[model samples]
Target: MDESTGLTIHKSEAVALTQNGGLAKAIKPLTKEIHLFDTYVAGVSYLKDKTVLQEIKIKDRLTLQREDNKFDDKAIVVLSSDGKKLGYVPEKDNIIFSRLMDAGKLLVAYIIEIKKRSIDYQQISIGIYLVDF
Candidate 1:
C-alpha cells in the first residue's frame, strides 16, 4: 500500500507476508518524494576548487543543512555527497525550505542539470524534494 497516494498494490505485485511475522517487522515504511522547486546553486564561484564542479552530474544527490547562525536567518547550505561545501540554496529561495526544515520535515536536493560555460563559470541546477513517509 502506498499511503501518500492511497494506492493499493495488487496481490500479484505484493511481497508475500511471512508466517512468522519477521518480514513484517523488517519492512520499512514507504516514502513518497514530492518535488517542491528547482533552483541554481548560489555562490559557486567562491568554491576553492572550481574544477570540482566539472565532476558533478545530473541526478547527483546533494545535502541541505540549515545554517541558523548565518546572516540570513533563512540560510540553507547545500553540500556535495562527500561533504564538500557547494554553496547555498539562494537567499530568495531558502525561506520556505528553511521553514520546512525548522518544522522537522525531511527535504532533499538533487542535481538536475549542470551547464559549464568555462573553467570559471558553471551553473548547477537542483531540484528540491520533500520526503514524506
Candidate 2:
C-alpha cells in the first residue's frame, strides 16, 4: 500500500502506478481506487476492424458494464472510452466481478498492456479496480 495516497499495490504492476503518472492525478479528488484483478480483454478477434485495437494505449481508462441478460448471466462487457464494445471480461473471470456490481459497487478498468502477436492479432490486457468515493 502507498502511504502517501492510501492506494493498495498488488503485484509488481502496481509499481507502474508511480512510473505511469499515478492514478490519483488522473481521477477526481476524494475518489479512492483498489486494484482488483488483471486480465486480457477476451474476444478481440470478433471485432470488425482489428486495427481499432491499435488505438488503445497503456494507462488508458476503460469501462465495465454488467450485461445481466447476456448468455452468461455473469457477463460484463468491456468498453472503450468512446463506448465501443471491446469484449467481455472472460466468462471465467466475470462471476465475482458481476456479484460485486450486483451489490452496487462501482468497478472500472484501465489498459495495462497491449501485445501484438501477428498482423491480425493483438491482445489488450486491463487492470480492474474497485472505486470508492
The candidate scoring highest on lDDT is 2
Q: How does residue 69 of candidate 1 score in lDDT?
A: 56
The count of backbone overlaps in candidate 1 is 0
Span of 10 residues, lowest total lDDT, candidate 1? 11-20
Model 2 misplaced stretches (Cα beyond 4 Å): 1-28, 49-51
lDDT of 1 by residue, 16-124 (tens): 5544574655454566789999999998988986655866788988989998655788988888887788889999999899999999998889999888867687889
Cα lDDT, model 2, residue 42:
89
How many residue pairs clash in each candidate at the backbone level? 0, 0
TM-score of 2: 0.74
Instruction: Kindly give the stretch of ten consecutive residues in candidate 2 with the minimal lDDT sum.
Output: 12-21
Per-candidate TM-score against the hidden true structure: 0.75, 0.74
